[model samples]
Target: MLLPQPRESIQDNQKGKVFFVALFTVCFFIMHYGIFVFVQTSMFFAVSSIYRGDLFNLSIPALK
Candidate 1:
């Protein structure tokens, strides 16, 4: 504890913490999206078959 404290209000402290948390969250999600795309596009580690999963599969034929 110092004898003379620099000026800082509670709101200022809260705002700083909030800003840091938001920045961290944004970075985290960006990294998450990048890794997700890499895995889905570049890897076959997924055991559940893409066809069996009943979602999107480019191999299936499309009707005109």
Candidate 2:
């Protein structure tokens, strides 16, 4: 009976560790994806503004 108790406790500890590791991995992936999307959107807007000639006047003034 006592032998079974230690085995059960060890299994529970392992399960808990696995659960936390998986949770952290999922959160990390979500955060990385969010940052990637934000950067892509910002770059798209910057490129579009430049393409529309909106940034030309701004650049000329900066060069002066």
After superposition, the stretches of candidate 2 with alpha carbons farther than 4 Å from their true spots are: 1-10, 50-64
Model 2, 1-64: lDDT tens digits are 5343344456765888767988999999999999999888668867665343343344433344
Per-candidate TM-scores read 0.49, 0.60
Clashing pairs in 2: none
Error of 1 at 22 (Å): 0.2
Taking the tens digit of each residue's C-alpha lDDT, what string does model 1 give over 1-64? 6463344644665778767988999999999999998788544524443333333544433331
lDDT score, candidate 2: 0.68
Each candidate: what lDDT? 0.62, 0.68
Worst 10 residues of 2 by lDDT: 53-62
Candidate 1: residue 59 Cα off by (Å): 22
Model 1 lowest lDDT segment of ten: 45-54
* Superposition-based RMSD of candidate 1 using all C-alpha atoms, in angstroms: 8.3
